[model samples]
Target: MKAAVLFETGKPLQVVDGVQIPELLQGQVLVDVHYSGLCHSQLAEVRGHRGEDRWVPHLLGHEAVGTVSAVGAGVSKVATGDKVVLGWIKGEGQDVPGARYPLVKDGKEYLLNSGGVTTFSEQTIASENRLVKLPDGMPDKLAVLLGCALPTGMGLVFNEAKLLPDALESQGKSIAVFGLGGVGLSALIAAYTTQPKVLIAIDVEAHKLELAKKLGATHTIDLSTENWQEALQAICPGGVDYSFEAGGKAETIEMAFEAVRDAGGQCIFASHPKEGEMIRLEPHAFHRGKSIRGSWGGGSQPDRDIPLFVELYKAGKLPNLELLLSHEYSLDEINQALDDLEARKITRALIKIAGE
Candidate 1:
C-alpha cells in the first residue's frame, strides 16, 4: 500500500510507494480509503507536537471514508462493499493526556488497544463498530467529511452543549463560535438549525466571515481586528448564552469565558488546547451559574450521530461540506496541503486517495 510516511519529526513526509498495508486483526475491518481530510493532528505529528504516538515511517491519517473490502474474525457491524466513514478514538483509559501522554513508535502500537484506526493509506484498519455505513447513493466525498468534521462540529452543538429547541427566552438566545474552520462553521450551521437569534461567528479571516453569513450566521466578527469581548457584548447586548472554543487556543478560550453570559449560560471548550497549557479565568466566570464543559469528538456515539448528519445533509439542512473543501492533493502533496491550510489558503483542505 502507498502511504505518506513521516520518517522523522520536523521533516517532510515521504510518499513511500510501498509501505505494508497492515493486516486486520480480530474485531477490525479493512477499508480501501477513498478520501482523507488533513487534520491539524496530522500536522502536529509532522511538527512533533504529539510527542507520543508519533509514528515515523508510518501512516498519519485519521479522518477518512472508505468501503469495506474485508472484515476480520469477530467483526459483524459491517460487511464487504459497505461504504463507511472512519473514526479515530483512544478508548477511555488509553494513552490520553494527563501529566503525560504515552508514546509508541517504529511500526509499533499507539493505542491501549490495536483497534484504533490509522487512515492515511490506500487500505486501512478500523474498529468495526466505529465505521458508520453511508446510505447508498450519498456523495462519497461529502459523506466522508460528515464522518469527521461535520459530526464533530454539529455534535458539539447538539450533544455537548445540548442547546434547547426553543430559541428566545428559550428560542432566540445567543451562541458564539470562536473559530470558523470546518468544525466551527459546521457548529454554526448546527446552531443555526436551532434558530438562535444571535449566532456570532468569529475568525481572523474576512473570507471566513463571508462564508459564515452564507451559511446562516446572524452576525460575524473578526477576532483578529478588535476586542472580541466588546464586539460580542455589543452584538449580544450582554454576554452570550453560549460560547464555544473550537480553535483550541488558550487565548480563544479566554474570549469564550468573556463572551458567555454569566448565570445560566455555558462555555463549551470543543477542542484540546496545546499540551501542558492552561487557561486562567476569573473564578466568577463560573460563579454566577456559568457552566464549563469539554466537547470531545463532538460527543459522538458514532452510530447515533454520524447518520443524523447524513440525514440532515440529505434533507439540505447542512451545507455541502465539499463547498468548504478548498483544495485536493495527492498523498505526495500533503506538505503543500498543510502549507495551504496554515496560510489560510484553503478553507477546508482534503486529499484524494484511492478506494476503488
Candidate 2:
C-alpha cells in the first residue's frame, strides 16, 4: 500500500510506496479508504504544535469514508463489503490499540505508528470501535465530513449547546460562533436549523465570513479589524445565548467565552492549541450563570449521530454542505494539502485516496 509517513515532527510527510500492511489484531478492520479530510489537528501534529514527538514515522488522519475489505477476530460492528465512516471518536465494538505498518524508507526499514483510526493511506487498518457504518445515498466526498468535521462541528450545536428547537421557545435563541473553519461552519449550520433570532460568525478571513452568511449566519464579524465582543453586542444586545469556538487559538476561545450572555449563556470550544498554553477565565463568572467548557468530538456517539446527520442532509437541512469542501488533492499531494491547510488557503481539504 502507498501511504504518507510522518517520519519526524516539524517536517514534511514522506509519501512512500511498497509499505507493508500490518496483520489485523483482535478487533482491527482493514479499509479501502476512498476519501480523507485534512484537519487542523493533522497540521498541529506535523508542525509540532501538539508538543512531543514520540510517535514519529506514524500515519496521520482520523476522518474518512471507506469500504471494508476484511475484518479481524472478535469484530461484529461491521462486516466485509460494508461501507463505513472511520473516525477517532470511539463507539460500540472492542477497543484496541493502533496498527503499525512496516515500510522501507531510504534503505532503512521501520515500523510506522498509527492510532485506533487513521485515513491518510489508501488502505488503513482501523479498530472496529472507530468505524461507523455509512448511510445509504450519501455522497463519498460529503460523507467524509461525517468522520470528524460534521461530528465535531455539528456536535458542538446538537450535543454541546443543546440548542432548543424553535417550537420549544416563544422566541428564537441567539448564538455566535468564533472561527469559520470546517468545524465552526458545521456548528453554524446546525445552529441555523434552530431558527435563531441572531446567529453571528466571526473570523479573520472575509471569504469564510461570506460563506457563513450564505450558510445562515445572520451576521458576520471580521476579527482582523472589528472587536468581536463589541461587534457581537451590537448585533444582539448584551450577548448571545451560546458561543462555539474553533479558532485554534486560546485568545479566540477566551473571546468566545466573553461573547455570551452572562445569564444562562454557554461557551464551548473544540480547538486544541499548542501545549503549555493556558486560557485564563474570570473566577467570579460562575456566579453570573455563565459557563465555559471543552468539547470531546462534540460529545458525539457515532452509532447514533452519523445516521441522524445523514437524515438531516437528506432533508435539505444542510443545503450548503458542499461549500465546506474547499479544496481537493491526491494522496501524493498530501504534503501540499497540509501546507495549504496551514496557510489557510482552503476551508477543509479532501484527499482522494483509493476511489480517485
lDDT tens per residue, model 1, 1-356? 66666666777776654454445567767788998887666676777665754434455677788889998777767889988877764322122111111224355543222226666667776766557777654676666676667778887788887763334544686899988777787788888888887998998999988888888888888977977777777888768888877775777887887788777888887765666778888886677877877777878777777767777777777765556776788877888997777677767777789743
Query: For model 2, what is the alpha-carbon lDDT of residue 180?
Result: 85
- Reference-based lDDT, residue 195, model 2: 85
lDDT (CA) per prediction: 0.72, 0.90
Report residue 210 deviation for candidate 1 (angstroms). Answer: 1.1
- Whole-model lDDT for model 1 versus the true structure? 0.72
All candidates: TM-score:
0.88, 0.97
* Worst window of 10 by summed lDDT in candidate 1: 92-101
Candidate 2 lDDT, tens digit per residue, 1-356? 99998888999998989889878899999999999999999999988998867988889999999999999999999999999999999999999999989888779989999999999998999999999999897899999999999999999988887763344661388889998889999999899988888889999999999999899988999989887767887898888889999999998899888888887889999999788789988877778989999999999999999999999899888888999999999999999999988888899999999773
Q: Can you tell me which runs of candidate 2 are displaced by over 4 Å?
A: 164-167
TM-score of 1: 0.88
